[model samples]
Target: MTDLARVRAAAERLQGHVRRTPLLSSPFLDEIAGRRVLVKAECLQHTGSFKFRGAWAALTALDQGIGSRGVLAYSSGNHAQGVALAARMLGLPAVVVMPADAPRLKIDNTRALGAEVVLYDRATEDRDAIGAALAEARGLTLVPPFDHPEVIAGQGSTGLEIAEQAAERGVTAADVIVCCGGGGFASGIALALEGSGLRVRTAEPAGFDDMARSLASGQVERNAALSGSICDAIVTPQPGKLTLPILQRLAGPGLVVTDDEALRAVALAFQRLKVVAEPGGAVALAAVLFRPAEIKGDTVICTLSGGNVDAEVFQRALQRQAVND
Candidate 1:
């Protein structure tokens, strides 16, 4: 299981490999939230997402002889790119099983990072089955997106950074909002921030708010749709078995934001913070900006989880924001 000690160890492993993403704030964002808002720009991390931290941590933790055989993963985009890039850097082969409808930019980028890409249908195909078969046949290690202990530990390193950074700013108590898909990222942070005066809250796209519903019911809930929202990066069937209990124990009530709100956040992030945040990445920021009544205290921290958006999608977000302005 992932804990504070495991997270600390992962941080030590990731010290030189991972970039310590910045905790950014904008006066404009604070004005919108009616509070002080800080954005953790994980979109600036390697592969333009926080997944790189977990990927590197998981790969490096493996026995050298086992790692030499290569790695395999299934993701809509961000995790695939993270694993692919990490594998390339480590001189190991990678194979990614992705949804056929995933952003083309992400698919191309995965291949460019030297991973063999396998596309599957999100509606009919079982990604796990495909990945398992490939891994078994090729003797490849599976790098789970959110369920594994080491992966969660690696992701928790972000929470460590948040804790340190918030203290540096003289902010002791605040909500640490995260764009939660399968709960790994949020759960990891929750573990890291335990008793640190910073609490974690999950954010999800409105139609796909399984985490929010799951938190409310104290049991796992599944999303009805497989694909529809623009926030693909943080979309998953349900919270992970390993990650849910941690979240249920440590996280605050979950928050849900509409796709439009996410797009607005993406645009606003680009305009104000001068950072690019894909829709899924911006969901936590969207919750902070548009769901103010749900959040407590005068200060808030949220993550911009990834920036692997397609150019057309990014342009659309910017155009909509322009029209609204």
Candidate 2:
């Protein structure tokens, strides 16, 4: 588990490198949900996701000479772009091993940031295996997406900001809703919110709710399938080894949202809050609106993980909403 002190230290280190994204509110959503809803707009963060904070924290923690040799990582998309951008900023070479099925914009933006890209089939190839071999051959440092202490602590910066921002708005307690993949985001925040009077919960796509089942079972569990869900970003095979313990200790029962619910949440966010939230990114808001029983506070803080959805997908969500109405 990432300690609050380590998270605070990460905040200090991320002073200039990371963006303090706004905590947005929608009276419309509040009226419907029957609570004040605060959306931490991480979609507006640099590289368009909260992943940048963790990537930078990991990079900065390594020995200085490692930067010259470079770093290698495996991500579906967000973390790859985050690491690519971080390495670019630090003047370090970056190579990302990405699944061939990752969103196109993410792959494009990562290369645009000057990192070498290695594409692999998620179902056939082991990404970690490829990344490790490449790192050894190229003499580059390895930065796993969510398992490292620094990475988890760095991701906790998101929760730290919410605590400060919510306090500024006179909200001392809120049910922090996070879109969970490998438990890093929710676990990190839960650690940061320790004793702060706020509780954290994770929202994941229906069939891919490994963390949710794991929390309920009191042990880590793997998902049955990973490719069928529309929420590509949050479909990990299982929770991380390091993140599971923290989540087990701090987070509540995992909330599960269907692909359609996430799509509806994406459309609602656009019509109500004017934010372009991807399906996986909008799952927390989906839980807030459709599964209110899981939430325990009068105020809810949601992390809009990213806004990297392709153009066609976003349009289809809006179209579905029009037909339903």
Candidate 3:
């Protein structure tokens, strides 16, 4: 389990840098679930994703000598932009190795943030191997997207903010739900909720439910046939080694929703809350409204993790919603 003290220190370290995103009450969700639902709008976060918290934390945690070295990382999308922007903020050079098939907009945004982009084939190339070779050649530090302790600690800052925001509003015992990919965001949030009198659960798409299957089997299981989903961000084949134990201890049974459900949730967020939630970001909200039994509290906090979807994807979600209506 991640130490709460270290997470608190990270929160302190990131005081003025990361946004303390709003905890919004959702009447629509409350009506459907018969309970109060709060959405943590991390879609408004830097880089339009909560990944910035971890990237910033990891970069800042380095020693003075280490700071002189550039940073290198492998990511599908969000983390790539996050590390790129964070490195720029800290005046550190960054090189991000991303899968060639990742969203083009994300790739363009990352490059615009002043990071060198190296694209590889996710199906045939080992991005980790390529990133490691580059790191070694350039004497740069390798920042793994979701497996490092500092990265986990940094992501924990989101949970800390949620807790504080809830307390300030005189609420307690919230069931905090977050979308799980490699389990970084969920594990970090659970770490922050350790002593806050709240429960934590993870949500994911049905076809990409690696963490759910792993939890049920009592061991990590890699999905051999990775299927494409609207929620592209949470489509990891397996959970991170460091994150699994933390989640096993802190999280309840993982909840899974369909691609259509996730897309609908994204549309609902736009229509009801006037917030644009990417499919991955809307998964938590989908769980709160669709999987009430898995959630444990009258007060709930769902992490809207990112809002980086392409315009075409967003429009498709809207069209699907319209057709259903």
Candidate 4:
């Protein structure tokens, strides 16, 4: 279970290995939203995403015998990089199966981190099947992007930090908006903040808002199509089995924002906050900025979970803001 104790232990395990990214606030955002806002900039994390925490925690917790054969993982982007980096830290090799159409930078980063990259056709092949086959054939341990206990506990460390930091800032209660893909990050944080007076909410791409639908219906829901959005890092089909229950119990009804809204939020992050946010990472900020009235609190915390966007994509998102100006 991903409780406070597990989260704290993970935090202890992560002290020197990972950076404690700062919680930042902006006068510009506060003025626009008419409320106080804090952003947990996980985009600045090692491997340019927050997935590193879970990857490191999970890998390190395993037996040395398992670590010797290396590890296998399936991810479109961030999680692949995370696992590759974690494996490197532990002197283990890694193999990552990624979609053929995943962002070029993410693929390149995974390779640069020393993992062997295997590409699959997302439109035609099953990533899980491919990963399983690779693991079986090579005798590698498989680490899923989400849906694991150790991974969830590692992710919950973000919430533990947020709670303590918020308390230090005199925030007794707040709404925390986090980007949701397979629900690992969202549910982990939710579980960690269980008694801290902070409520978790999710933000996802409009057509791919399965977590939102699942939360409302109390059942798992799959996205009709994973394609057609720039948010490649968060195109998961449904909430994870282990993560959904926690989200249902602690998170607010999820919010959906358009790709355009997400792009604009990315632009705003660069212009105002001076942070790099990929489309998936910007969804939480998009929901908060574009639909401020719908959010429930005077004080809010939004997690910018990743920044591994391709240069061309980042250029295009920034150019849109220039055009609008």
Model 1 pairs whose backbones collide: none
Error of 2 at 281 (Å): 0.5
Better of 1 and 4 by TM-score: 1
Candidate 2 residue runs with Cα over 4 Å from true position:
100-104, 121-126
Off by over 4 Å in 4: 100-104, 120-126
- All models: lDDT? 0.93, 0.88, 0.86, 0.89
- lDDT per residue for candidate 2 within 81-148, as digits (tens), equals 88999999999999988889877777788899989989998789987789889888989998888888
- Expressed as tens digits, the lDDT of each residue in 1-325 for candidate 4 is 7777887788788889998998988898887777898999999999988999999888888898888899998875788889999899889989999889977777888899989999999799998889888888888998888899889888888998899889999997999999999999998899889987899999999999999999999888999996788998899888899999989889998999999889888999998899999999999998888889879778989999999888888998988878876
RMSD of each: 1.6, 1.6, 1.7, 1.7
Using Cα atoms with residue i matched to residue i, what is each candidate's TM-score against the true structure? 0.95, 0.95, 0.95, 0.95
- Tens digits of per-residue lDDT, candidate 1, 186-255, equal 9989999998899999999998999899999998899999779999888899999999999999999999
Regions more than 4 Å wrong, model 1: 99-104, 119-126
Give the number of the best model, judged by lDDT.
1
Instruction: Give the total clashing residue pairs for model 3.
Output: 0
| Cα TM-score of candidate 3 | 0.95
